[model samples]
Target: MSVSPRRLRAGALALATLAIISTTACTAGGGGGNANGGAATTLTVNTSFVLKTLDPGRVYEATGLTAVHALYDTLVTFEGSDVGTPVPALAESYEASADATTFTFKLRSGVTFSDGSPLTADDVVFSLNRLKNIKGSPAVTVSELSVSKTDDSTVVVTSATPNPNVPVVLAMPSTGVINAKVAQENGAKDGEDAAQGDTAQQYLDTNSIGSGPYVLKSYDPSAQVVLEANPNYWGDKPQFDRVVLRNMDVQTQKLTMQRAEAAEISLDISGKLLDGLPESLQTSGVQDTVYFLFLNADPAVSAVTSNAKFNQALRAAIDYQGIAALYGEGAAPGAGLVAPAFPGTLPEGEASTRDVAKAKALLAEAGLDNPTVTFNYPAITYKGVDLGTVATKVQGDAAEAGITLELNPQPLTTFLDEMRGGKSPLGFTPQSLNYPVADSLINNMAPGQATALRSGWTVQRADPAVVAAGEQVTETLDLAARATAMQEWQRLMNQSSPYIVLASNSSTVVATADLTGADYSAAGWQVDVAAVGRR
Candidate 1:
């Protein structure tokens, strides 16, 4: 039986019902006190996440990336809530050329993989080159950067063009360094070595061989992933000897947290639900994620959405404040395509806000009074808030401006298939930043990118001014100059109204009172397992 969107969001009761009737039992009973009457040191995190893979290069989704962060070390990383700054991780130090096209990294000595293999420049080069050769969604993280071994402890990365944000991009978990020898022995295919196709995917999918604080004990895609402390890890050992990441419904997660069967819950639970949790459970810092509605500007998709006046009307009609409220605390009405947490984002005064009268005037100018358009959205909650609620609010507010919206909500998988395939005329989607950089947002959302294609805004249909402004933002190397250039790009984008900013959200994670040291970096999943310990 297919589940309805309402039932999915109202997780507790419905999930309890489903669990009682299902033949398979949920893995909801762990992290309890030890049999000898001592407190258990194992840390169990309950989440509504389905991990895709353990392979760093192949893992692109948020949940999988979080696990990768715990298991692998990247060249650069962010500490705590600072998303703009990049700190050295595997690289002891790094320097960029004046042109910003070339970066040279000096690896830390004495670091070894879980298997005790000493980390070398060759491993860094191989891991990076392999990621690009694999050509996965995360390959873009290093796609433009060429890797070379300068010495046993040095690696040089040269970009095709000047990119000052190379270090920030490398901070992504997908750029995690892997054990080249282990990977190759376990069937990893390298450049010019895929004669029989990459056979290492399956092996790496379940096993992790990194130089981080944890080693993969086991991974079951649908159920749970077990991780144990790596004894040979060069960094500080994690407080917990064992960590279990269980995949379960949000309702089960809540129950586990209540019963003290889990130490933490990382699922996107609503603020309302979180408020009801006992004072012993508290929310950690927020992650960088933004939700928005994209209007197909291609006339071939829908003439109504393609009309500039109509797009403007829709933008003005949206209740940005109301939607932001629904997202609860730590969410603000989106200012620009990039979140305010990142550099090069527009300041508050430049962002557009709701204006009902202006919306009606635009509708009248377009000769589209009471015109109807379908707004497609995923039925599930994103980042702990129901996107369906956001769409409904848009529908009601648009009607007040003499516009009619037909809501079409579908399962996330189906919704994405249609939206990403450019079949949906209008859609609501969340853009999660792979790295805390303005370029990541612009490259994905603006003209001549994948999102532009998905929204049916082909290059020919893209606004020349917006395209030109985007180029200026891209080529500018100085951070201050880029921010200034982005202002122009954002102005052009706001005028075009291809996509209306809804809200910029920070991902929330609730944990028991005693659990501390959760790192909610803007990268979405940089939780520091090494620091999370009992008070």
Candidate 2:
């Protein structure tokens, strides 16, 4: 779910279902409040969303993950922010082979889907297979895996390689379990050709049939997604009878909260905008998204940026602390490319410290002076942080070190095209993990991987030791051993990699003070709407 902001789509039509109107509209944000200060019947949340589909197997963006989470339950899930371990959800217990290639899960008995149908191993098998054969962006998480049903209450999964983190991978929202019978009747396919043959997406856009806390009431791509409490929900009933996730901008979100007009929680407000907020509003910071800049290693793009000496100079010149400040409180200098919450992330003290003298000296050593490089970034406020402001700060800091940065901000689509095609000599962007695992972040920087390919880094050009360390980290399943291997990889990357980590920003959620379950998590759905309730 690369933290890139999704632009608004045009001409999206809404479903004809009537909306559940909030009661007592004059109360603090959560709609339909009791006249005498009791529980609210409806919860309204506002955020700038990039929602494309409601289908669990196909959703890959942040907002889509949040929505799918409420509608469907995964085989396993993390508690609070404890991503280090996965707790059972649909599966009551699970076991992995010593070789880490095979896993068996025992489904929880008596669990029923929203439609009151009994859940079985068949649903688990169908969900994982549909996730894989559909070949959507999320399919990468389940790559090299096969799922099968052993009995009504038992299921087994196998990986092509020794993947110790299969449970953690299963915790991803994309792996949410679906009602097999209902989905199949609605045109779902799990065969290898499902990528083209699967026709369940349109059906899922309006109908949600899963054993989760909520069911889809209606969905509008451009406007809002509405949910109602599932009568057959296996767990404790959700606090609100109705939850409305509206696609409203941050400005409207702030105004709504201030006026006590509608929305109770806001997921897209910038940290800088928190000042002067009313006393009724409270905020929780989830610092997980890591922002970075990368220089293309391909000489065809720019011989100067490809030079190792120039890369070192630029890394030394940038003021990491100053950049971290731009994200306001809760932000910090990135410890490594991995988010700080991940177990294997580098220690805080290992973060970069700027030294302009070293930068100038390195530039001289490279036999270059007064060199100018064009810096490219998407010209939009992604997740409330304006890249242009960050770019201007970087440009100013670079100027002090005798380097010139030519800022070229373009439309997000064009910028992404150039960056992905390796046409951008230098680029700035933020990336969020698709799943909560160290491998999800570190693996991208490996030779020939997604981020590496974007930066023109190939195995032949990379340090052999760095590549070996990365592989070791991925192959090692032991927690402490993997942490050691991750540290070595980060140390090597800090030395020569084209990527320079800027800062990790906190994802802030502004809500009314009385909201009880405004909890935050780095894994799936920054904040769980199902958990939100009045104090």
Candidate 3:
């Protein structure tokens, strides 16, 4: 038996099941957690998001990807609101057979890599094939798609199936193209170094060769990363001469934003910071971060947390209001796995409701609500929890549901180790599913102690349904069938909070009056800087 992982709930919902809850009133700002009103001429964005790697192929970490976007561009991309639809970036025009399996792309003629080599069909094929051959970040993104370069200027991508979202996947920076010459000459891996070539870690420490709007200038560990505008950029020149990413303490970064050292401030604010900031300044709560306790779901260590009822009890017991208030600065209550625009997009009280009754019922069903559990939190320097506001609120809420929740905060690396090492009983980490593909997020939704990429969490927890649907969508070269299949996929994830889906944070951004285009989503994914302007 093939296990028929694809058979979700039997009947599929007709194309429309539930409209994706628009977190914003359809406005990027509405869904964003920042008070990004300034139109500064030069944005001095001071973020702790130091560049760990410049290689788009393997830079899956949030902080790393933030820097990659500045120095690289992808083939196909997305516009506002849509997840899979393709929007032009590197590719000027493209043609796909009516069946949607084979796509032919025509690259702009004059585009050149940062290394000065002209971009062409060969480069496109080289990059895609490299990604497919590699075992790192972008590999999963490009895994199922088949590729071929028809000629010097045209590349054809053939999918196992007809997929409308192939363009979206292409748009992803992980699909960012690299210079074949640079990769060859240095005996280095550009991006596909993860599984095969040289590894992103080896390549990015010293080299960056892409056909992006910006070119790499310098990198100094976690201290700083600098990029000068690529003069040979295929697109219009950026408004700024350079973009600098700096590393600083969360509190200092906040202060820097207040004092205008940085053009922007992003928040995944910790309770400790919220309490320490000047009262007047503290109230300037920007919608910046999401706070949710993730269950590592280890059968041996976290049997209770892994229980569906336990997950329900914990979520239901949460006093979303109190925690939000504890974080202060006018933090709003969070709901579901996603955060919605306050007031209009998400009706007031939409996610803030406290259902004590529902919680109690869940705890009783779990038969172990009173079970003792310790949650490992990332450290303070990185805005990791101090275990007071968030954990306390959770502790109190869980208490109401007859469960005892304990907090144990550790350094980021240590906490990461316990969770990834497959030893953590319970870990408090926040996660987001940015692409709208529920299956892609299964790594974070492990029911059996799923390991993260860096940490040892195993990928075995990936539901067969998720895997099948994911695979089918990639291989299916037909539209109606793919759509029909995806509808079922989305619904299954919605019903299964196997990961105990918590709040999807809003990325709050505050910038000096100089830089523009520093929008962070409520979900913390960096904003696309194609149209960004800097003073």
Candidate 4:
């Protein structure tokens, strides 16, 4: 167990190789050092997906989100928990009116955008209402808000009814506060008329302007983005002076780490790469983020196809823990859609674990005997984390459950497009796109809420009763009432539209022996850069 840091670091290097080759990460964070141990630290990180655009509104995918979080800060920093339990970010604190339908935020003053412009209450008003108007943007995000500014430093945001997660949604990186002036200068598209076919400024796609710890130094699209710390950061300044993110192939990233071009290997590695690591790397020092299949069952694809029983059967067929084990030692089986770190969210009763018998029984009830389904996974190429193998195992499990499944692995672009677009009948992906607020996760896939793209899988939306219940849930600011509504919402989802419950990915940090400050706390859905440092 006491392998020298040398032996363990080598193993970590090998694991990094496998992760990079086999799979990709959605939101990249962690790993850095301040060379002089001053307020400036520059560290190189790895990610398979490149930032498509720096604008948060335009590019909403996970990879592009990595850069967005650093470039812009939201009103509420998704703090405390990732599954939508929010603490204050820009708004110092929030208080709900007696009815919970009304909320008032006391803004943090002296906060300026990267350009030395003031971030006033007015910008908050513009950012929000604009989010609701964007035709093709994520629809469910803005459903509950009714925002108005009371003063330059005071903003009162209300829900259409009893809404508690308003602050949580505001904190998500997707809701990063844009400098109203800068947004206009960059030709930032207003969400109000995106579907009207208005061609917004194409240049804003590559440029960024907001309030964050780092400002964009340079970007080469498919190559790399260089970031320099902002001297005027509202809070503690970044430790690094400048950070360089390179977009090398999986293998190249591996070689560079051994050569020390990369002080750390941040991408998930392949199983084969595990062979490259010495035994010490396999120890507890390394961690694993969970992987699961995200299934999209849009009604647009087929009517009988999105059957509740069919969905339930698919959920029961595959073994999540078994699939996780295929990766290595760090994986854990999950029982619900919401990961455990989120409070009051995923309790045992909320989701069902593996039951082959239940799977068989459910499929038979759904009359989906010998059914063939297609599974879409993000195209990954690392050696060890073979989704293909998981797919193959799922196929075998389905066969035993009297169901047939076809497997498809694709690149991130295709996977996200088809999944968010809601074009695919069946696909497997993660719901890791959560904020600190519970509603952030709930609303995304909720009834009457917006679908990621338009997959048309709002099975619950088709039912009016469900819609009313969801609205009533947001209408209450009372903690008890909100919890009740969430329970009912999840209860209905579990009873009717259950996607396969997958594993909650765990965080594993690999660093040089000299590196420290490995504290991992819930900081929104994002990995907290501020929490990272040397021991």
lDDT of 1: 0.74
Angstrom error at residue 478, model 1? 2.3
TM per candidate comes to 0.86, 0.90, 0.70, 0.70
| Model 1: residues with Cα > 4 Å off, grouped in runs | 1-40, 195-197, 261-265, 349-351, 411-414, 458-462
For model 2 the TM-score comes to 0.90
Best by lDDT: 2
Report the error of model 2 at residue 167, Å.
1.0
lDDT of each: 0.74, 0.79, 0.54, 0.56
The true-versus-predicted C-alpha distance at residue 319 of model 2, in Å, is 1.1
Model 4, residue 405: distance off in Å is: 4.8
Clashes of each: 1, 1, 33, 46
Error of 3 at 428 (Å): 3.0
Worst 10 residues of 1 by lDDT: 9-18
Q: Candidate 4 regions off by >4 Å?
A: 1-41, 79-85, 115-117, 126-140, 143-146, 182-208, 254-320, 327-330, 348-384, 401-430, 434-498, 506-526
Model 2: per-residue lDDT, tens digit, 1-535? 1111111111000000112322221111112223223554888888776677779999876677888889899888876556778899999999999888999999999999987889898888999999999999889889889999889999999999888889988988889888899899989999999999999997887788788888887777667887777877888777887788888877888777776633378877755666556766666666667888889899888888898899999999989999998887567886677777676778879989999999999999999878899999888775567889999999998899888999999988788889889899999988766677776555677777887988898887788887888888888877668877888888888888888989977666677766766655778576788878776
Output the lDDT of residue 149, model 4: 89
Candidate 3 — what's its lDDT?
0.54
Model 2 poorest 10 in a row by lDDT: 8-17
lDDT of 3 by residue, 1-535 (tens): 0111111011000000111111111110001111233441333445565344556666665555666666777776654223435667788888888777777888767888875678887778777777676666557767778877777878888888555557656776677788876665655443444355554445554456787776666665456656666767777776766566666656677666455533443434333344443332211122333455566444666677667677666767777766666543334566433333211123234454567888888777767646777866665432443444465667777777777767787766677666666676666655434443433333343323233422222346445665565466445555556554544543443334343333433334344434445444321135444445544
